[model samples]
Target: MKFICCGNKGSMPVNDNGIPMDTKKETEAGEPKYGLGVRHWQTFLYFFALTVAYAQRVNLSVAVVAMTDAAAANINFPEYDWPEKTKSLLLSSFFWGYVITQVPSGQLARKFGGKITLLTGLSICSVLNILTPLFADWGGWQLVCALRVVEGLCQGVVFPSIHTLISTWVPPNERPVLGTCAYTGNQFGTIVMLATSGLLASSSAGWPSIFYISGGVGCVWSVFFFIWGASSPAEYKRISPEERKMIELAQASESTSEHPKEKLHTPWLSFFTSPAFLALIIAHSANNWGFWTLLTEIPSYMKNVLGKDIKSNALLSALPYFAMFCMSFVFSAIATLLNKRNCISTVVSRKLFNSLGLWVPMCALIGLAYVDADQSNLAVILLTVTVGFNGACYLGFQINHIDLSPNFAGILMGITNCVGNIMSIIAPLLVGFIVTNEQDVEQWRIVFFIAAAIYLVGNGLFIIFGRASVQPWNDPPAKHRRNSTPQVESQH
Candidate 1:
């Protein structure tokens, strides 16, 4: 293959000898350029879907502050005097339901297609979000926790379904850039919610407005996706024949024919025993511990320790995620460039990026542990840089499931995410125990230290054991002939 620099488009490698090259997967010679094709449009929808889903998921985290503290919102708004332990329970309740559906949702998406699975989950979550305020008023924090649990249950299919869709819709050559773009919606949603929820909570409409707005957007996005979304290239009736052919050719290794509808048989034993898969589980769980701790606790930390008002708390909390959102594109572009230029093996690239994402946050957390109320500005900057660099992991362990088994990417994500979210459920409750006094800097320091230590340990395991290359069990002999999988360039 010959690599030609395509400027901002990166290197476009052309087919040489009898081998097909990366560029050929999405763009055939004499075909329209792969820019803004229907597949790209579909990916954009996936990005929007995730953004909407996460907005709904996190609105409560910010709103819970205003709901509990009368001074956090308009004086006229209702406030509950829930204790810190109760608040922690409310925050962590969502993950209780979230962990339950991960494995099942992946199987459902595989059998019925990602389109139906994702839309069903989103639509239900939207209705539940819109009704959250009423439930909180009627039944208090207990009811609110129940409502969140149901919402989490409905939204559980989101990432798993998206993984399945990506494995089918995205070509191997474009997966790094496009897949990262789609998942960056997670950070974007957090940014939007954290930025706006504060102002909305203090507005005349009160904290309820936060829920209403996110729910409305989710509902609208669901309708849009229902009308336009396709589970795979084969399902997209509006896709051009050339574009469809290109995507199918690129995904040939994952499917038996143009669009194989068979439900994949997961190798449960192999997954449990594989060092690479176990490493992924640890990396994912560690990321969740740090991520959920920062995500769920930052606003409270700003409020109780730094003495920031709700509005300032929201805006400052959002800064880190905004940095994270922008950093995702930078990471993806650099990863794509490196892969295109043949500057690194897939294993090297994955490990290098994953380490950067984890170690920087570990150091930042260690430093953040020492910050006092007077050093709030320094604290915010450290948080921003920490989360910003965390975006590098999108190219790391986040997409490693597809690298291991495109055919079972959804299943892999479900299994790993299940384990990870269990940590999400634990992190908040653990914080409740460790930081009995939210205003106590020493207590908060322990929380940060634990998160940082987990980050260090998780990345260490991944660096030692992670493998980006396709495993032998990815395509079993009974289901697929050996060597039948068509590798899209050596990068696959």
Candidate 2:
């Protein structure tokens, strides 16, 4: 309960009862120490948990590529008539469960601690992943689809909970880096899955072992996370006095209070009425449609259109995510740099990044539409850049969760993620319709064109309307701020 203030001006140590000690002359001491601490360790644990969730979630894409081949061997299907549709269904079924559970999972994160909700979700997902290959032949494709759906549902809470954790634990100045670091898990997970799955699948052991490996990793990470992570800074035992003061100061500046113990009444109407929130949802939804479609479909595309084998296909499919992982850090740093320099407003920085991110992919998709499958190397490069640009959108939307409402970041992220997940349903169905004949280059062009157009429209809306300021509903009036104690500390 004690507080300490440190700065270039000085240091003032305050007692637990809020009494200032007579160290007035010593107040002007030196610079504040800022680096990794117990809270940072907590953040690291949450980030690790998130990485594990993403690793398990995307492992299926790699597994499906191998699974189809294994299943084909068992059924004695011809190479040309392989069960591609069934494979696509398995990849897409996870999205169905993921999209449906976002809101409820977020609610759970808000109601219970994020630590408990996320840990429980990962536990369920790990068990289901282990059970997947076991049920593959016994219950057949239907059982596999059911298990995937279950995995998706459990994994759906991962992002929202992580968002909440970052909002709670990281200071404003550090959020961009933290957010980017947290999101890098998805790209890293994709890289690990794509890189390893094929090598494992190519062995005599076959495809099911890929699931087992990824499942085991998740289970192990879950144990570490449960041990190391606390729900919030207040619950942490080892947070330094200086770091705690920094968090308190930043929260006060942002005007966010500690989350109440009681369940928040749903402000559905208020959320629905916020045009800026709606714009963000639409923009992110469109981005997700384009991103997930490419992610889920790329392996099949590589094999069918480029005629690549499992090893090469896995390598090619992973290239985009690796590029994305690199780009996310660059783009997030650019936004933060812009904010610090006063080169642009936060709203403008977000809009600029969002527009560029969408437009780059649009051009790439268009180029992809015109390129022949014979130009396989060029096609892969374009696909890599196209998906890499997808990470840029995070600079806009991901940071906006904290920008708009640090207090309600968990709920806000849940809402955005829930709405955006609608695209998960749309993307697979759209691809199914457009790429009815996967071998036809022209047919696939239509899918790319549609994705490009959607991104364009969404970015345009964000440019025109998105605002980075906190929601009016959550902000106190100027008079209220004036009336409050000058030394009041915000708790978040």
Best by TM-score: 1
Which portions of model 1 miss their true places by more than 4 Å? 1-33, 254-263, 477-492
Residue 151 displacement (Å), model 2: 1.1
Global lDDT of each model? 0.86, 0.74
Q: 158-240, model 2: which lDDT tens digit per residue?
A: 87887777877777767766667777777888887887777777776567777888888888988887766767777755555
- RMSD to native, candidate 2: 7.2
Q: What is the Cα-based lDDT of residue 393 in candidate 1? A: 92
Per-prediction backbone clash count: 0, 5
Instruction: Write one digit per residue (lDDT tens) for candidate 1, span 56-172.
Output: 988988999989886769878889989989999999999999999999999899889999999999999999999998998899998999999998899899989999999989887
TM-score of each: 0.91, 0.86
Query: What lDDT does candidate 1 reach at residue 200?
Result: 97
